[model samples]
Target: MCYIYSRLFMFFSLLLLSFSVYLIILDFVYIIEYIFIIFNSVNITYIILIDWMSMMFMSFVLFISSMVIYYSEEYMNGDLNKNRFILMVIMFVISMMLMIISPNLISILLGWDGLGLVSYCLVIYYQNIKSFSAGMLTALSNRVGDVALLMSIAWMMNYGSWNFMFYLDIMKNDWIMELISYLVVLAAMTKSAQIPFSSWLPAAMAAPTPVSSLVHSSTLVTAGVYLLIRFNYAFSSSLMNFLLFISSMTMFMSGLGANFENDLKKIIALSTLSQLGLMMSILSLGAYKLAFFHLLIHALFKALLFMCAGSIIHSLSNCQDIRCMGGLVKQLPLTCTYFNICNWSLCGIPFMSGFYSKDLIVEFMSMNILNIYIYFIFYISIGLTVAYSFRLTYYSLSGDFNFISMNLLKENNIMLLGMSGLIFIVIISGSVFNWLMFDTLIFICLPILMKFMTLLVIMLGMLFGYELSKFNLVYNLLSKNFYSFFFSSMWNIPILSTLGVNYIPVKMGALLMIFDRGWFEFYGGQNLSLLLKKFTLLQLLSLNHLKIYFLMLLIWIIYLLVQI
Candidate 1:
């Protein structure tokens, strides 16, 4: 039965993959046609290749989506909802395609909303309480971002007309362009999990591994970086300064948060936020190609890391807390091996994919002496990444293997295969994908040397982490939830006024205490009554009917007065 189901899943996945490729081909054909029309002095309503950035973005979506579809087949192995998962994954790819190929704001919005909706469904696929809550948080947070984007679109339509090609035409209007650029950056920061709006991503770790793989690595989060690059031409100098400041701040804070996290997934989650901040900073400097290059490399290594972590957790019967894991190298050799490779790449080790991309970003910023401060932040972030990566690696793969309860190590062939493939991709990305972007000598050499220096910091930090583990000082800080404490304190004003009071009432009253206690029946009855009121047609009619009757009576009285 399993074999039959696997075969069916493979068949459907291949079909969708083929369709996505065909769509890419179709988009290229249109691009070529539009280009030909432009050169021939023909009347072209839509601008194709408005800039090389657009073309690069389209190519990125095509390449990443292709990789995602291929990877999903192996990741979703043996799941009953395999078909449904594939469907959403394909829809996500298609929406991304639409976003890059969109000639107008309306088309782009359709793609944006489409991706958002499908992502919500994918996040909640586990259907548990935690998954549902995470999904809700993701939905709410993204909706706020989406509203900003929608407002920008509406503003453009009113002032600049509905034509998407207006961006190219209105490039000279500095003030209006800057205003629009700020609005777009606001949306991008929210979507990319930058500071002040980053809580959703750590919560989103409740999602399944493949979903996390997709969100962090390739699809949803990439959209924000893509947006910044796409609108690079429209931004003014002041806007760029603002972006650089915010991006740098986000990088520093998120790295600090990652350093204090105990959960392996949340560490990666925070790291992703930091990496996106780096990419945004690059984009702020108008280095679109470099930003996109870093985005591509980060996606490959981060996904590999996440999947490797997932494989370890699965083998240990879903143990995610790094404190519980100790010395798993021998038992899970493949996972440990891949995790080490991915960690090195993530920390920007010399000759690795991350080193090449990250060095380029640093060199791009190094053009100004003041930008060295930004480089300092990047250096600090690199050290922290190495520390956490090695901490995770050492705790899970190098220490004594006494804490784990599970003895039978069931190897997940499909998961391992998927992870191995990503590891292979990361290994070769510097050589193979290097041709995709331009790199200077400084870009090439600086990151390689820095990687070694960063490695030393990692070694020292790991020793510190190990010693602290023995004392268990940091473990308590990690488990007591460092990030959550900061978040609660930051949002304490509203919580104190509303949520705190609500909880206080429950804590004080006997009836409310019973409801808050394990006796769910007390609230269950009230909930049922509310549900009945919501669903009953008579209640709906009374609500709408009363309003309509009032309107009719007002109109009758007006008619009588007019007749008199």
Candidate 2:
């Protein structure tokens, strides 16, 4: 049943992809608008903006989702709720498509809220405590973004319309209106898991790999980046600089955290977080197109990377600790090949998908006269990317076999079939997207020293990774220090978010309950009701005798005679 439904979605997705391809070839933009609701002067409508960007993004999403659905057949072969999983994934893709086409804030909420809710469902699909915890975190963190978007919508009421496309140019001159960009950036930060919101991305690994592949890699996480891309025209210089700082810190922090992570899936999740930071940072630098370009390319390789991780995990009986894996190259030759290709692309190796987008972003950042902090974080994060890539590669493919015994690790054909599609794109997506999106390569003049900084850092990172892998006592010893605990625990953001954010509110609620039940209800409500009852009884008692009624009648008669 699951297979049938998955194949049906794949077929439908392919058809959508074909339509998108045709739209892209013609360079056509199709806009559809109709009034959804009208109240006095304010009119909310359904606006779908379909252009090269939307069609391109939609096609990519459909293609990847189709492949993910197909891949899940074998990966989740015996799972009882495989159909539910497939359905959730398809719904996720639909939400992404809605998000991709809408230019209106109200319409965007449909997709954005859909993504947050569906991702939570998918994350908790495993029905375990870890999934529950992770789901709550993922949902709550993204909920912040949802609230921000809602606030932006409310703020947009100043313009008398929800369609931001019409207001971007005019918004720049209005200081109060420009505040929407800050709200948008705040929303983007949470959605992209920047800094304080960073904990959820790594914890989201509790979800199944397919969810990680589709939701985390491309759709759910990148929604914020996509939103910023749409809102790029309205961002003030101050907002951009602020976004730049936050995103830079996010990129650096995720990179540093990845270096200390041992869980294979969490490491990849951290890498995704780091790449997200890069995209956000570039967008903050006012290069929306470049950020969008990287978003697409990163989606390709990161999906493939997660799929490879899933395959390896499936073979290893669900083991995800990189320390437990070694010398897989000999056992899972094809899987290792795919894994390395994706890893190399992630490192931004020349001619690969990541290089086209990532290297250009860095080069452009270098050419711009930015602050020293931005410069340092950008370059260091890039190098850290390579460092973690090497560390992951060494631990999984080249290190001594740490498994207890020789184990069977045959490649699953169906899984490989799904990966094969991405593998081809991982190799060609860069050149293809570059040709399709840009008329000419972005030109930047730099000295020889600057030109090769990325390479130099990558090499340095490799050497550092290799030496650290061997001489780990010092790094390990350093990791035991107080600051190390902070880094390893993601600066205790998870604890803060879960414990810190939740504790005060929960405690306050308990105190409120005590007040309500003990004092407020007893004295203010219950005792008040009892006092009213006693007063009524006293009034009745006062009128109990027939003489009292006669006395009242006589008083009324006297008052009437006096008035006459």
Candidate 3:
């Protein structure tokens, strides 16, 4: 059943990819509307915007989803709930498609909320405490974005239509539009797992690997980036700068967190957060096209990365600790190859898919005259990205095998087959995407030293990663040491966003409950009931007094008539 569905989605992916190519070749944009409502002479339509961008995005999304479903055939083999998992994945893909094609905010919100709800379902699919907690975190965090989208919808209602595409140009000068832009950014930040919202992405690792690969790596998290891309025209300069700052911090935070993270899936999740920050930061710089370009490229490598990690985990009987894995290059060579390719690609190794996007971002930023803080954050984030990449590599790929000696680590061909579909693209998509996305050369002028700075930083990060990996003093690490615990705990964001955010409100609620049950209850309801009970005679008289009065009035009227 999963196989059939996987093949069907693959067919759809190929068809869309071909169509996207045609659209790109022609530089065409197609918009069609289905007017479903007529009120006060206004035509409210459900709008579908089909252009190169939507088509391309839809193709990539379908491609990754198909691969994930196909891989699950083997990865989820013998699991009773495999069919249900595949179904949920298909529903997720449909939701992403709905989001991709729709120009109307209402339809987008439906798709947005759909992704959140289905993801929560998928996250808790394992039916365990950890999975349930992760699901709750994911659902609650995502609810913030859903609420933001709802607010955007409500605010845009004043325009008489939910189709925000038409109003982008005019919104630039309007205060309401500026407010909408902030709401949209807030929505984007939550969905992308930016600062204050970063913990959930890692926690979502409690989900199955396929879910991690498809949802966290590519689809669910990127929804915010796609939304911003669609609504790019409405951002004011102030909002853009604010977004820039937030995304930079998020980028740095996630990169730092990834280095300290030991769980295989979680490290990748943090990397996803970092990449999302890059996308958002570049988008804020008004290079939305570049952002979208990076987005597609990142999806390819990261999805493959997660798939590769899933293969490893599935083979290892669900073991996810990096410390427990080492020298896997000897046993699972192909999977390791795939993993390394994706990892260094993520590090922006030259000529790889990640290289095109990341290098371009750094160089593009260098050309701009930004403040020193932005430059510092941007470069440090890049270096931290490389540091974590190397750290992951040193721990898992190069060391002596640390797992149990009696284990069999054979490769699963079906999983590889699914991954193979993406590996080819991961290698060549850098050059291919660069060509397709840019019609002309992006002329970046920088000095020789500046050009080498990226490479220099990457090398430095690699050295730092190696040193961290070799440092035998285990007690000095982030989660252990008091000083570095801040970085290890993601600046204590998980603590803050969860316990910190909830503590006061929850305490207030407890106090309120005490007041309600103890005092307010007695004062409002119980006391009133007691007073009524005390006056039982008057209560009974009150109940019958109306009938008695009516009878007396009738008697009086009869007497009066007789007298007259």
* Candidate RMSDs in order: 14.9, 14.4, 14.5
User: For this target, which candidate reaches the highest TM-score against the unseen true structure?
Assistant: 3
TM-scores, in order shown? 0.74, 0.88, 0.90
lDDT of 1 by residue, 1-564 (tens): 323433444454455445435544454334432332454654444433324444444444444444444555655666788878877776876676667666566557767788789888988888999889778877877887788888777677546454445574475465655666777888888778776667677777887776787679867888878877777778877888888888887777777666566788988888898899889888888787778888878887887788787777776777788877877788888888888888888777778889788766665565554555776876676666666676677667776775545466655676666566557778888656566344343433445555455556556656654564565665665647655566323233323433554686766786556646565765577866997899998887788997878888999999999999
Better TM-score candidate (2, 3): 3
Name the weakest run of 10 consecutive residues (lDDT summed) in model 3. 472-481
Query: lDDT (0-100) at residue 367 of candidate 1?
Result: 54
Lowest summed lDDT over 10 consecutive residues: which window, candidate 2? 1-10
Ranking by lDDT: 3, 2, 1
Write the number of the candidate with greater TM-score, choosing between 1 and 2: 2
Q: What local distance difference test score does each model get?
A: 0.69, 0.87, 0.88
> How many clashing residue pairs are found in candidate 3?
0
**Any idea what lDDT model 3 has?**
0.88
Judged by lDDT, which candidate is best?
Answer: 3
Clashes of each: 0, 0, 0
- Candidate 2 local accuracy as lDDT? 0.87
385-489 per-residue lDDT for model 3 (tens digits): 888898888888897999998887998899999999999989998898798778889999999999988888889888888888888466344357775678868
